[model samples]
Each structure stands twice: as structure tokens, then as C-alpha cells.
Target: MYAYYGKEKIRMQPLHLLMERGHSCKLADIVKKCLRLDLLEKVTMKKNSALMMVVLLLMAVVLTGCASDDNQAATRTITDMAGNTVEIPASPQKIATMTGPSYEMVFMLGGKDKIGLVRSDHATGYPLALLTNSDLPNYPTIKGVGPQTPVNAEQFLDAGVDLVLYYNNAAELEKFKMAGIPAVVVNTTTTVPTTTEEYFEQSSANLKLLSEILGGEAVERYEKWYAYLTKNVELIAERTKDIKEEDRPVVYWGNTWGTNILSSYSRGTRDFEMELCGGTLVAPQEGGQFPEINKEQLLEWNPDIIFVDNHGNAPELVIEDMYSNKNWESLSAVQNKQLYRIPSGVFFMDKGSTNTLVLLWTAKVLHPDLFADIDMIKELQYYYSTFYDYDLSEEEAQKILEGWVDAENLVR
Candidate 1:
């Protein structure tokens, strides 16, 4: 018999040849020969079983390949602002922040629950922990955080913190990295912002970075806040931009605690606010360094309008000084009763809480005829509810315009 072997024909003896003529034949030839029906069925069944096993194994391999992506994304790596590469979970479950400004970012992002330690001993938590949010006042304050202070590694470990946020704290960031934890830097200005525009830029950057990490209502809230600021600021800018340089009001900003000069944000962000509101800074053309000027210098610059920061009740004495002092009586601001105190709520509005409110306030005060339609209280109500997630009643907003004292009882 001729059997096809690949493309060639080979002569082979049938299995029956051994039975019929007792001829020698190889096992291959025997298997190919028509011997018995039952034997043939058994051989075919064995080959089919082996083929089925191979098909099953291939299917499993393909399924595993499909699920590989999900398995790999269990963790991720990111580079922080300080250029430190860090490995973090795909979603952070535990978090800690070192500085107050960073904490402020976290708190606004609704990541307060993710925090490991409650806070560092120093708790400014700017624009974040408002007096309205009752929980912030009572959050546990971690002590011993300052210049030359080492991070408490055990706190992170014990609290199961997976991520830490610092403001340019390289040493502490390294400590977290060495301890098998990831720390990211959120750059905030320790120095004053030279201009209001720069201040907004930095603030928006911080907010956006935090939103990307937290991944929730943060982005929406931040966008709304940003839009709100831009709309009002642009309107103010348009009104003020074309004003003649000579016509711009000369303004002075004082940061005095009682009669004492604690510090001043001259030519700083707040000073820029005066300019954008159609006024000239008494001390302009400076950087983020809040330069100190004496009473004599202030007299030399006899500003048309004066704004005293409400920091440590400076407004109380500043207002009194303007009202009673003989030296101040010579100034136009004091004589015309333009000596006003900057407003505050959770924190000072002019300080850091929300400058949009103050910007609007300043613009209206500087050019009342141009900004007649603006309602400061309504804006504050929107800002508090929209940005901070706290409700600001009409009364509360009005109180915020005056000073922080009236808004002390506000709650989230």
C-alpha cells in the first residue's frame, strides 16, 4: 500500500498483512493500516483529546493578556514640582501635608479625610481652613514643625500615610522617600507677590495641581473660582486701564498693629490691587519684598486714599489715629475720610483668603461711578458657597466687607 508522507508516497505493508501473511511491518505502517474498527476509534479519540488541551491553554493565555492592564495600574509614578520622582498609588488613600498653605489646598480639594496626621503645630491653612468650617479649628495639631525641624517619620508610618505634601522641604521630602513613602512639593510663595496678577497665577497653579491629584469636585470648583475672578478682574481692568496716569489716585497701604509698624505689603500684590483698581501705589516699582517705610516717608507721599490692614486689629488704631492725630490731619486721606480698613472673613480678604472680593471692593471704592452696578455682598455669597463649600448669607457677606469680627460665628 502507498501511504502519503508529507508530499511523498511511501510503500508500506498493512497491519492485516502480519495477520494474513505474517509479514514484518513498522509500527507506523501498522497504525496506518485498516486493522480493527474499535482500535481505530480509540486512536482517533486520543489525538482529539490532545488537540483540545492545546486549544484550552491558548485561550487562557489570551485572557490573561487582556487583564494585564488592570493589574499594572495598581500603582503609579509622578514627578513633583521640586523634580523628585515619586511612586504613588493610582489613587491616594492616605495623605499628609507639612505646611499651612499646602494644607489649605488639601482641605479645599475635599481630601481632608485622606489626611494622616491632623496638622503641623503651625496652622495657617490659608484660604482652606475657614472659620466657617468648624472642624478645622479642632483638627489635631501636630507639634515640632519649623525651620531645621526633621519630619517625624514614625507619624507617617503609624498613620499609614502613603503621600506627603511639602512646600520646598527637600530634606523632609527625602526622609519620606527613604521611608518608602512618596512626598510631593506644592510651591507656595513664602515671599509676598509683587503684583496681584502674579499672586493669582501662583494661586491658580497650586489649585490646579491639587485638583489633578485629588480628582473630584476640586477641578469644577477651581474653574468656577477662576472664571469668577477673571470676569470681574477684566471688567475692572477695562475700566481702569485707559485712565490717564496723572488722574490715577495715589494710594498708601499700611500694616500697623496699633501705632506700631509690624510690616507692610508695599508694592506687593495688595499694592497692585490699588493700581488695577485705577490708583497709583505710594511706594510702587518694588518686588515681593514688603519694604518698610517710616511715618516721615508716608507723609512725604501724602496719598489720596489710605488702606490699613486688619492684621492684629491694626484697623482699630489706624482708624483712631487718622481720626485724632494732628500729623495725619494734614494728609488728604485722613482729611477726606478715605482712611479705610481692609476687610476679612475666615482670613483677611486682602491678606490671602479671596482677593477677588477685595479687588471688587477696591475698584468700587476707587471709581464708584464706573463700578456702580457691582454688589460686593452677592459676590461674597457666591464665592463662599461655590469655592469654600460654605454658605455666605447676605448679612455674613456684608460683615465680611467690614472686618472679620462680625463673621466670627459663621459655620460651614
Candidate 2:
């Protein structure tokens, strides 16, 4: 057979002859036999062009996938106190504290600028937070989902919070997760430590985790604060370890909760604090953490000293009421005027970072002669300056020790 291509005439090869010649024909040879071209030659050019397009597409897809992976790598995973694995921004810029105390904790870690939201009652609960950080009150506040408040996921999402420090609440955590917010449960009612050692261990772990999340100077800050806390704990332990059981005065931590004068802390941190400071806890462990006892029970215990909670009523007013109330007149704490207001700044001294200072203060109150050398005022000054970067005047330090709030600066 023969064929004409434009002006040239080409001879066609017989199928049997082409097959017998070779299965592998060169490009020039295949083009020359245009009239006898096989199906393979017809599709070969199209197939190579299609494959090149596919290769370019695959390369584009792979490069795009790697970019996506790099974006995902921006976050890091951490296990919170509740043992939930949470992926959060490696360096979170906007932090929301759902718990009242966590605001102070984050603030101490030098994350003041990173705070975007705070608990509704944080201002009132922690007055010094507002006083020290002028911008604290400017952040949006939300009521946490708990026994008292309902969950509102929209509020968290609207705030653009990158990270949330919350109390252990599974429902709240789920809500936050659904809103695409990273939440960490740092505290739980069920995990309250019964001993000072356990409390310190948990507190130290929490501090370390928080420091890791915040990064930067926060790590060094946690180390310094923890060292100070450990040194003070060891000092107190060394001094009080030798005290005889009989010599340890019976101490009670009293609180006025919503017109109830009999409210007191039993077998929790308060009890441990009393034990560490060489004082006997007047409240028995069986009554629960915060128990309400009758006036008769108070008289029976006859606690040698009382540390009043400044959360509810002012410590001064609580002490004044206890002194005037005829039912409390016979109590040793009232009769001897041994009631002292628990010092609080940013948060209660009985809890949080200030608890270390409370250990020294309680020791001084219990055994003046033993801890007389420990200057609490200087300690407070140093703590505020070092941790919070706030230079507390001597007068302000004394006010905090006296459980006096800065009512003028307090967020209403």
C-alpha cells in the first residue's frame, strides 16, 4: 500500500513485515512509515503529553499539601491536669481564663498582654489583678458554665480566644471544643490535695505546664517562683518539724459565708497549712472541706488562734462581729484576740502562689519566737516585685497583709 502526505508519496509497510522487522522502532522509523502506522504510534504523543500534565499536577498537589502541613505544625499538643490532650497554639496570643484564680496565675507568668477574657467575678474576687494591671478590666468577661451559670460558646468564639484555662468541666470543655477553642482544665474539686506535700506537687506541675504553654520568660519565671516557694517550704519544715504535739496550738480557719458565722475549712489545704505551721487544726476531717458548725461546737474546740477568710465580709468586720457576739465571747480566739485576717493580694494567700507567703505568715502567727527572724513584709515586697513586676510600697504590702482591699481601684 502507498499514501501521499502533502506533496510526498510514502510507501506503506505490510503488518507482518513491520512486526517481523522489530517490536522496538525508533521515532524517525515510525514517522517514516506514516501510511503503515500502528495504534501505539498514534496514541504515544498524546499519552506523553497527558503524563506530563499529570506530573505537573501531582507536583502542585504535593507542594500544596506540604504547605498545609506546615500550617498545622504551628500548634503543639499538651496534656492538661484533667489528662485531656489538647492542641494549642505554640505561642498563644489571646488567652481566656474561665476560672477566677487562673487569671492571677496567667498574670504572674507574664501573660498579662495575652489575656483576652477573664471570669466575670475575677475583678471582685481578685482586686489586685485590676490594681496592678490597668488593662485587666478592659478585657471582656464571661460567666463560666457551672452550677451558677449557663454555657455560652458564642462568647468564647466571639472573643477570638486562642487558649482557655478552665476548671474541670467536661460539658464546658466540649462546648469550647465545638467552637474551635483550645481549653485546658487546670483545677478540679475532686483533686483537692489533703496534705501540703500533695498540694505543692500539684501546684508545681501546674506551674510547669502553664510555663511551657506561655513559653519565653514564663519558664524562667516559674522556676524562680517555685524555687522561692520550695526554699520557704523547706525553711518552715526545718523549723516546725521538731514541735511537740502538745506545744502546737489548736488553730481554726473561720469564714463568714453569706451571714453564716460558723463557716470553716476542715481537711483540705487549710488543715495542711495549719499542720505545716506547727498548729493543730481544730476542725476535724470528717466535716468535709468547708463545713458549717454550731456555736456550741466552736466553744468545745476552743481554738487558740483563728485565721479568717477575707472572701465574704471584710476581715475587720468579721472579727468585729465575732468579738461583739455573745456566743463567741467564751472562745479562746475571740477572748485572747488571736483572730488574724488571712492576707490576700491578687488572690487569697491560702491558695495560689501567695500560699508560700502564707506558710511563713502562719508560722510567725503561731510561734512568734520561732519564726521571728522571717520578715514577712520584706518577703511580700520581694514577691510582688519579682513575680508580678509590681513595686509594692511598704504601706501597700502592710495593707495586703491586713487583708485590706483597694476599694478605689476595685472593679465594680
Candidate 3:
């Protein structure tokens, strides 16, 4: 019988011919078993052979193409706060990071080429020179967001973006949805993550995701940074594990210095870094976000160490001026001169800027005796060069450190 094959007609015999005609036919058996069908008419040997070859060739070609495409897709996965899973396309060529801190992650992953419009805040004070460049195609300039003004979605679309990576904030999620861009939330700010491994696992996973997205040469450099950071965290954890709980440094975090000043003490994702370093919060209380703290309450806690957030009522100045009159000399930190300022440039400098250098700085300050060998300046430069792709000179690092202290000293 003539069977239509593409543009040609081929003669074929039915499957019954194989057994009825006593034909020792391997081809017939294969067709019947593999294809799982019975031919209504008999097929000629030549036609049957050609059909089989065509079928196998078509499958091979299709499978080969599919495998190649699968390989080309960039493989990445992100874990959200609810433990939900998100897999990103491999090697995303156009990534638009909505959050400031997430931009750092993208840069660390070697995604400079793929990066599309970056958050406006990244344009200013971004430590890495490459990121700070205004000429880059993906980053557009957005100004006029004061201490409280929020960013708009239309501005992000104007810059030509693909993905918006950010921390999981309700207000942001709503805005991102309104913007109509694909969004993913990554939570790095946690007050207490319950386990030591749990604390860094998210961060390490984020770095891994970045490496995979960037792919090729960029992955190697990022891995080196990730390895170094992981090693240091492990070292810090091991060293501090043996110290008594009571011995851990008690700290206070000044969020801002305005009317009715607020501070975070073991709060939700806000003071995660401080909490992870085994530092106790000496504030109104623990586990609440940005609780209002009066001066009397701060003096009452009498923390072992105090860290000013940045540039406001400098903790140093507050101590110097109020110490004599406020009965602040009773605090242990006052006696030992442990009062210090978190480097504003690295910490409070930019909301979008992820100053990872602060982690090492925090580690060193929280456990000076254990981490006596740590050189914060050198470490800061290393991270600056590795993650930001800019060589943060020792002079620059020193200036940043001094700037924090100087901000306080100037008030006198």
C-alpha cells in the first residue's frame, strides 16, 4: 500500500505479513514493539527501511538540539524567606537588580555584562569603580529620593531592565509587581537565624547563584572571594564558641539620630549581622524591629560596647559630652574605651550598597582579643578589589575608618 511520507509515496506491508509469511524479520518486530502499533497494510522492504532510518534520524537531531539549548541556559536558584524555590535562567543576559544590596551580589557573581538598569542609589557611593560608572548602559540615574521618598516603577522601566533582585520587603514587593517586572526576594538581614550554618547558608547560596549566572571566567574570581569569606566566618565561629555567653560583647545599634531616636537590638533581619557575631543588643529589648530607645534606657543597659550607626549624634560625641553629666561613666564600655562607630561609608553609606566589608569589621570589633590578628584595612581592600573590581587603596580604607571617628570628634 502507498503510504504518504512527506512529499513522497512509499509502499509498505502490514505487520501480519511478518508472521503469516514466515518472514524472519527483525525490522517488523522492532516496529511492532518500539512504535507499539500494527500496520494495516504490508510495506516493501526498501520503504520500511527508509522509514525507520528517517524516524531515528529525526529523533537524534531533535534531542541533540534540545541538549545544546539546555546546556546554554544559565542555571541559578534562589531561596526565599518562606523556603520557596526560584530557578533563574542560566546566564541571564539582562538582569535588572532593583535593590542596592542585590546589585553587589550581581556584580560579585561576574554579571557586569548582563547587568541592565541598576537601582539609582547604586550610581552614587558604590565602592566598586566599575559599578559607580555613570556611562554603563544598564544603570540609569535616579535622583530626588530624600530620607523618605520612595522610588517609582516607571523609572526602572525607562532604564531597560529584565530582573529585579531585592530584599523581601512588603512595600517593595507591591511596588515591584506594580512595575510589571520579574522579581525575586533574597533575605540576608536576619536578627537571629537560629543556627550558625543557617546564618551564612543564605549568603553563600546567593554568591553561588551569582557565580552560576555570570558563568565562565567570572565564576572563578567570585568563588575565591566566597571561599575566603566562608573560611573567615568559620574561624570566627570556632574561636568564639568557647567564650562564655556572658563574656560576649553587649552592643547597641543607633539606626538614626532624629526626634525620638530608634535603635535595633536582635530585631528581625535588621540586626542580623550584630546578632550573628555573638554580640548582645543593649537596647529597649530584643526581637523587635527598631524599637524606640530613650537615653535613660541606654544608660540603664550600660552596654559593654557601643556602635554608632553613622554621622548623626556620634556615639563618641554622646559619650564624651554626656559621660560626665549623664552618669554614663558607669557603663563598662566607657571604662574600657570600647565605644566605637561602625564605618558609615560601608554600613550606612547607601541602602542599596552591600558593604560586605562590614562583616569582617564587625567580627574584629566584637572579638578583638580573639581576632587580634585581623587587619580590617587590608581585608576591606581585598573585598573591594575582589567583589567591586576596584582596588580600594589602603589610604581610602584608612580614611573611611577615620571618617567614622572624625564624625564624632568634630562635634566637640
Using lDDT as the measure, which candidate wins? 2
RMSD of each: 20.6, 17.8, 14.8
Candidate 2 wrongly placed segments (more than 4 Å):
1-72, 143-148, 189-199, 284-289, 406-412
- lDDT per residue as tens, model 1, 7-120: 554443333322222112223234334235654443333356553453354344333443543454545667666566766666675667665346655665666666655553
* Clashes within 3 Å, all models in order: 0, 0, 17
Judging by lDDT, tell me the better candidate of 1 and 2.
2
- Looking at model 1, the pairs that clash are none
Give the clashing residue pairs of candidate 2, or none: none
Report the candidate with higher lDDT, 1 versus 3. 1
Find the candidate with the highest TM-score and give its number.
2
How many angstroms is residue 113 displaced in model 3 relative to the true structure, after the best TM-score fit? 3.4
Instruction: Give per-residue lDDT, candidate 3, residue 240.
Output: 65
Give candidate 2's whole-model lDDT. 0.72
Ranking by TM-score: 2, 1, 3
TM-score, candidate 2, is 0.78
Candidate 3 lDDT trough over 10 residues, lowest sum: 15-24
Which regions of candidate 1 fall more than 4 Å away from where they truly are? 1-89, 97-100, 116-131, 143-161, 169-181, 187-200, 256-259, 266-272, 284-290, 312-314, 325-327, 351-353, 405-412
* All candidates in order of lDDT, best leading: 2, 1, 3
